[model samples]
Target: MKTAIVILNWNGQKLLEQFLPSVVNFSQNEADVYVADNASTDSSITYIKEHFPTVKIVENTINGGYAKGYNDALQSIEADIYCLLNSDVEVTKNWLQPVLYVFKNDKKTAIIQPKLLDFKDKTKFEYAGAAGGFVDLYGYPYCRGRVFNNLEIDNNQFNDISEIFWASGACLFIRSKVYHQLGGFDEDYFAHQEEIDLCWRTQNIGYKVKYIGTSTVYHVGGATLQETNPHKTYLNFRNSLLNVVKNVPTRWFLFVVFSRLILDGIAGIKFLFELRPIHTWAIIKAHFSFYKNFFKFLGKRRKLHKKQNYNLHTSIVWQYFALGRNRFEELR
Candidate 1:
């Protein structure tokens, strides 16, 4: 099948230097490469044209966020497979082959993600998505080799294909039909947690989201948005809760929300005790704002609940905080 690989860039000239070479080397004969530049103020577009002239470039008139940038770039493209890769990743030679193989062989698979290692320190796995993604009961996403800010080095530890709650947006490979059917990434999401919402819908439709261990890449985590960026934190917090509100069963959703609130409260207290009042205040503000949008979020919850067929008792997210690693046994 023919493939079109799309990369979204936002003032990331330096990243394109490392990423473009790897991408060109890896996907040269197999996939058509396209760069969706978000009107970067830097010389990113000029560099792409000079160095990679054969590569397709779609420069946006405005700096639309990640979702919109990709959506706009992909609107008219026709290909059997569409791979959304981030600008900050360095791919291996065989990275796209395994994902392509899975899509070609597995009729039940709708979305697939590659094994992601950290770029700064190649031995360690990336935090965003190491080798597939899972969520605990409270909607917190963790992967086989990473949790939150904690990343485990690649030790040939994960060597199996597995089902995941979501594919990381950093390097998501999906069938074109499935992607178009789900309306691509939700443009409303702008950036964070959108892929998780997409995968939830894919699973709802009886499709599997697979993590192909053979496909590997190195991701420079937080290249687009720093971990401490208030906006990033806000979107992550709001959209994560939004995903649960719009997907999980009513009782489970309520429990998860309350559980999340308590967790946030504890985090805030910990920050204050450590004399990081700024972080403490931000957490406090996020909680209050999230509640203020409760009714609107609940309305979405009601609508999504009507469409859900599966029931969640204890989400894979909460499993992370459980007493033993055995809690993760069923997940693997």
Candidate 2:
């Protein structure tokens, strides 16, 4: 299969400078490399053109965040598989081989994520991806090696290949055909949890998402938005609720939605107690945005041909907070 590793960048010249070398050295032979610049105002595009003359560059007309950025750049690239890699990720040698093996052999698997370890520590799983992604009954996303703030040590527990509910966008490997057929991503999301929404839609259309744990990559988590940033908080809360609205099955819809409202309120309270008033206010703003877009998202839900039971855990929040189950192995 023809593979393309496309990195989405937006005024991340320093990140590109720091991390792009490893990618080029390790992946150039296995996959075509491209940097999809999201209308960067800095010297990012010029730098790529001058230094890495062989590396392809796709300049988007505007900064469309993650969803539209990829959508716009990908229209012109022809490849059987597309690895939507992040600019802040450092890939290892032979990383593409394992994932490509899965894609070539398994026709059913539409999306895949490699094991993501922390760039700073290297001994712990990264917060963005960890092993692979799974959602709770209430639409909260967690991973096999990470639950909330508790990240597990890299003990190779999740080294085996497995099916996952969603593949992390940080180092996602997906078939090109399935991506476009699902109408790409819901551009309304702009960013945050859009991968979950896309992966859910992929599953709804009878395709599988998997984790190729043998391939490992390190991520500089929070490269664009710090975890504590209020805007990040707003996008996460708002987009997750939007995902639930668009993808959750009808039988569990009303109950989950109502339960999430209460849980989100509790989360906001916790944020305030932690003296992060901005984040608490961000959650409030998220809820209001969700309210305004409820019917619009519901209309999106109505248009879908299928809605599978996407939740893997009964409740991650309950298991982590109320029951004190912090590890993925401890959940059940």
Candidate 3:
């Protein structure tokens, strides 16, 4: 299968300078590498041209964040599979071979995520995607080696392929045909959790999302949007709610949304107690934003033919907080 590794950049010149070499060195032989520039004001384009002359560049007219930036950039690229990689990831050698093997072998596999380890620590799974992704009944996304903020040490415990609920946008691989068919991510998201929505919708239409642990990459999490930023919290909280509204089955919608609001309130309260009033306020802002767009997202939900209920989780919040099941293996 023809594969293209596309990195979306928006004024992330420093990251490109630091991490791009590993990708170029490791991925160029297996796939066509492209840097989809999101109207960066910095010399990201110039640097790429001067240093890596062979790497392709797709310049977007505007910076559309992750969802629209990729949607707009991918239009002209022709490939059977597109790896929507983040700017701060350092891919290992021979990473693409295992991913390609799975795609060629399984026609129903629509998306795949490689094992993501931390660039900071190296031994721990990265926060963005740690041994693939799965969502609990409450729309909370966690990974095999990560739950809540607790990360498991990489003990070679997850070095195998498996099915998952979603693939992290940090290094997601998906078929080119399926991506366009789902109308490309809901650009309204602009960023955060849109990948989960994409994976959810992919399954809705009868496609599998897989995690290949054999292929690994290191990620510098929160390079573009810092975890401490209130805006990041706003997008994460708001977009997750929108995901539940647009993707959860009608039978569970009312209960899920109601439970989400209550849990969000508790989370905001926890943030307040932890002396992070900004995050609490951000959650408040996120909820209002969700209310403002609730009807609009409901219309989006109506358009989808399937709204699959989650089959693998009870409540990640309760499991992690109450039962103290911070490890993925401990979650019931």
- Model 3: colliding residue pairs: none
Return whichever of 1 and 2 wins on lDDT: 2
**Per-residue lDDT tens digits of candidate 2, residues 61-127?**
9999999999999999999999999999999999999999999999999999999999999999999
Instruction: Give model 1's TM-score versus the native structure.
Output: 0.90
Candidate 3 residue-wise lDDT, 1-332, digit = tens: 79999999988889999999999999866899999999999999999999999899999999999999999999999999999999999999999999999999999999999999999999999999899999988888999999989999999999999999999999999999999999889999999999999999999999999999999999999898898999999999999999999988888889999999999999999999999999999999999999999999999999997787684888999998998999998888
> In model 2, which runs have C-alpha deviations exceeding 4 angstroms?
none
Kindly report which residue stretches of model 3 are placed more than 4 angstroms away from their true locations once superposed: none
Q: What lDDT does candidate 1 reach at residue 119?
A: 92
Per-residue lDDT, model 2, residue 71, is 97
Q: Cα deviation of 205 in candidate 2 (Å)? A: 0.7
TM-score for every candidate vs. truth?
Answer: 0.90, 0.99, 0.99
Cα RMSD, each candidate: 2.8, 0.7, 0.8
What lDDT tens digits, residue by residue, belong to model 1 across residues 162-217? 88778899999888888888777777568888898888878877788999888889
Instruction: State how far residue 279 of model 1 sits from its true place (Å).
Output: 2.6
